[model samples]
Target: MEEKKVRIHLEKHYWPDEIRARRKRNLGRILALVGLVLTFVFGWVVGSTFATGEPVEETTDFAKLEAIYQIMSEDWYFGKDVLELQTKLIDDAINGMVDGGGDIHTSYLTSEEAKQFNDSLNMGFVGIGVQYYDSNGTYIIERVFRGSPAERAGVLPGDIIFKVNGAEVTGIGSDELAAKVKGENGSIVEIDFLREGVTVSKKITRAPINNTAYGEMIDAETALLEIYTFGDTTGNEVMDILDDFETKGAKRLILDLRDNGGGYLSTLETIGSFFVEKGGILIQQEFINGTTDTSKSSGFVTVDWEKIVILVNGNTASASEVLVAALDENLGEKVTVVGTLTYGKGTVQTQRPFSDQSILKYTIAQWLTPSGKKIDGIGITPDVVVELPAIMENGFEPLEEGETIAPDSVHVAIVSLQEALSFLGYDVDRQDGYYSPKSVEEFKKYQATYGTTVDGVLTQEWISRLHADVARVWHEE
Candidate 1:
């Protein structure tokens, strides 16, 4: 029997320096070849759309583009598909133009990828509802949607997936894995995962996930409204939640926008109207030609809340930032922003689908708050900056197996570890500065999620990973 190679692929973030540098070199060559053409085309398109009333010169020479394509087709070291190569050339040119400007939010999506992106905002898909990312050498689960099959199957953040449907997937990319995991509604798929060094198998049935926006009363007068992303139906969902809050007599509201990467611009306006005054500017859009437009709120304040606190983090971006700023500026003292700095994103992108079904999401305008605050590279500083400081002994050795730090034998490090676990969504009740059986159980769960030895003993690697995951959660939040 022939042996198969087990290939380990790391994400770009974990790529070696040489590999990244080589990629940059290749990218530079492609950019250099197509830079002029892209610039000319972009300018011409913009002029045609807006009609600046001034004549623009045509300086781009198409000969260079033809020459590069010819060289790649004939003299390239490998066999090439001219059609695919042309598509790639056009896509790369647009991507380079957008990326070169340092606007990470603007992107170019292929036909299939664009459909997936649109599907995320349309409603939901038939899948296990776990978001995974490629890490060091495995596909690590990043998030499990609430009430999802993955969550029901006990999938947790940091759990490493080993196989799908009896096929080894260690060498597959995250996108391919996602496609494999998703199926027709009511279909079943098998998953093998490594948790706490134990191989666990699960059979999860695919179903529609529609909990994009949801809320619950945290207390008699406090409600926690979590908006995962602003989408087509987000306004209606939020309105329904507000009605529910009114019915529940919840006067205090906590808007949780943590980990929300934002969605539709029209949805922002619709949602903003609930709090902002009627016909007030929600966000100002400034174009490249010194022109500006404003998206105004409908001024239909529905639910009345005396106190409102918005919980945001680095992942709160774009439309999320717009909503936060609108509420804070319009409502004044009634609204307060809590958490770390937001994920500074101030540009509004316009997605234009081409004839081939591909989509080009290009930055068309820079957004500003109603109060004229620009939140681009510099994120919006929270009114209350909350952070968990990592307190660890410089030379303290990690607790090994069988080396217990029980109630009688106390260790201050235990409290810090407990706090970390609690922040990472582990069931570590409270940071009582004691290593109890509860702590041991949660510690084991963390170990399982990270595929570490389930000895209930914290290792140096575990501590390091805990710190890193904490940072990751905050940044991705």
Candidate 2:
């Protein structure tokens, strides 16, 4: 027994070391499987992100963008030019900010769109300055600018632009349709429209619409002037009207700018000279750079201040407003601002032809009054705000007593008769939305005043006098 105890050093198994080594081997196997799964999941996520097929940001790195672009080009993922893709991206970005739906006043331009945009700014286009958009998935004209080709062709404000040159224009984007309507100056463009319950096909010629309103005189001392624009020539045109008015013995004036959009700044400056005596602050342009001061009568234009009225509405904007503000400040009672507030466009825009052979127009300055009133979003309120009083269907018709008028039909046909009667201050009390006997009587009086044919009916000659009167007084002011 003693010998056995001394000799027995039998090897005991090293259980802890063996078990530790085996555990480590098992952990390595598990880690290998997890890494495989992670690689597969990451690849799937990357693929899905690209293949989602929607308009979205591709990636945030130039290298990623380059790689994706190269793959698309070489792998034939899409059948289109890379430059075209870039152009489309640019167009989409622009349209998001400035398009038919973005701002009715501002729009994005393609090469074709550039043509249409340039045409609009130039006031030169064929298919009547009308634009259409999808409503309930069908296209409809949003509006037709007054005196535009469409309007001249008797196109209504709500007419639908459906076909151009015999092509279905439905779902045709606004930018594309606008391009189709624009063409070489003086060229004819054909359009098919749904107007007043009838589908009419009309061909319209494109030209630069004149910005000057036609002038007319009502009675001596009462002039009616219709202002179309405030272009550079407008000042000279008003001067011409004044010379003519002096001949007609017309002293009281009425300026009508109901549907006139705006134009050049110089014209307003010239207008200010007439009512604003000597050189004072007519209008000041506040730009990012500095303020531009425009003084009154600098070039020596003058106007009669005794009795003048400037008529304006939502359409009167830009330069027309400058005249209103100046006259409102200087002429006071001598000038009567008789309509609603004038359009409050205080910002100035400038156009320059680019070296890239493209032209760009940008907002340059904001306008301020001599009293330093900001002109954007807030128009000049008139002194005597007189609306013709909205009548039935719209009181745009003659203020007759017992007659009813056809909707949207020309009151012009019978308006002269009523307006003539109104001049004698006849029974305009009827305001019956029709031409009546009272209107007839007024018409006769106007005819007698002009010593024209006493037809007892409103004729072109009678209308002419009224228009001239409005043009002389309101427009020149």
Candidate 3:
């Protein structure tokens, strides 16, 4: 491995607020479902306030909280800045309120977090377009967006991001690594990575990356629409995609919502209006006060004709659920859901920014389908279930040196390993629940190519790599 020094060029001045705002307006600020978006019901309410009729009974004694704050501020073993302590206290308090309640969707966002959340809505960011995860000790590329600078630069899935700007980030936290990769548009960020034990470096120009929805005709009669996330412009984006689908003569559509975490409620409603009938109920929201509100479709039906199949996985949630439920309820036999069950987030969140710009995303109401089905903890079951095969994390046991499993071996783990290998494009002749000679040969070739021990045996590291490779290809394709 060669040591390389890479310097990132930074902009000298920040864009004016007006210019930034204009850029945001120009860019469709929304992800399909991963990025947070304002709720449709409360998005219009800014700086809302409530007048208390009476002092509510305190659930917990305030004196205990005060004592803790006093002890931390004054009597702690180490001295701390009052402002910093105050900020931490506020953050913890908010966390306790939401997180402690066991509602994963409700969250507190600090000023920085709030900024990032808002930035994601812009649908554009300056970075080498890749989403990664920190595995045991390596930073593995989970996804490389199509046409991204990273993709254009030959960044591939399952590649280990060993260094950013020549600095080793072996054990770096995800947030810190993200900050390192993101910069002003047009800036350069050098990335050094390990692709199958080979060190590769690329000088990537950070540019405005769009989180766009994808739609392409898979065949003359079938089209695939992959919704990345619902953002400000997603409704229009979807409409444009449908137009293209129509132009290409696609009659059957596959709506891929797998891994979509849910996005803007407004975007959901807008998109739902296209598939649902005019004046149809999109979702029913029940507030904490026992009052409920029913959101109806805008009565605008855009595309007409044929069958639709919605693909959902465990990560499909929130607004995505809304869209799925709406179309399922309204279209009935026209829509069929496939894949695993969804994330099952039935609650809607309202975001409010405080004076200090910190944001609080608290649950306001529970959303129900038009038929009055509540899908909170219990997710919407698919009509056609296609559960993904589980990837063995570093297989059951490493095949030690000098020990070769012949075709007679009937271990269940080997069967799983063979399946994974085949899924990742390896030519494993047949996955017949046995470790055949061809399987061993293919495994040895894979090991040799990736610099693994070429002993034609499995190890923990080898299995983990196999799992990652399969996942990468599964997701990317």
Give each model a TM-score: 0.69, 0.52, 0.73
- Model 3 residue 428 CA deviation (Å) reads 11
Q: For residues 1-477, write the lDDT of model 3, one tens digit per residue.
A: 895432111000111121111111101111111223222111235686645444434444454445555555665434354446545454444344445665555556656666666555435678888877655556778777767899899888888888999899866676678889999988999999876667889999998777557788878899899876666677888889888877777889899887666667778888888788789999888889999888899866756759999999887877788889999999989999998878787887767655656555667788899888999878889999886664423332334434445445766658766887777678887666577888888888888778656876665456556656765676566
True lDDT of residue 442, candidate 1: 86
Cα distance off (Å), candidate 1, residue 443: 12
Error in Å for residue 7 of model 2: 99
* Model 2 per-residue lDDT tens digits across residues 1-477: 563211110011111111211111112222222212110011234445454444535554443434544444455444265455533332333333323232233222223433434333334434456544343223556445556776687665445666888997855665577668877777888888754334679898875554455577777578887766565466777788777877777778787766455655656677667556676678777768675755555645334536888888766777667667776776667777877876676666554332333322345567777667886778878777765423211312223333433322345545443443343345654443366665655556655665556656543323434433332233224
**Alpha carbon lDDT at 323, candidate 3:** 86
Candidate 2 segments whose C-alpha is farther than 4 A from its true place: 1-83, 90-208, 289-294, 387-477
C-alpha RMSD of candidate 1:
12.8
Model 1 regions lying over 4 Å from their true place: 1-36, 39-60, 67-100, 195-200, 389-477
Query: In lDDT terms, how accurate is model 2?
Result: 0.53
Q: Mind sharing the TM-score for model 2?
A: 0.52
Q: How many residue pairs clash in each candidate?
A: 4, 30, 12
Question: Of the candidates shown, which would achieve the greatest TM-score relative to the real structure?
Answer: 3
RMSD, each candidate, Å?
Answer: 12.8, 25.4, 13.3
**Alpha carbon lDDT of residue 133, candidate 1?**
59
Q: Compute the lDDT of residue 167 as modeled in candidate 1.
A: 92
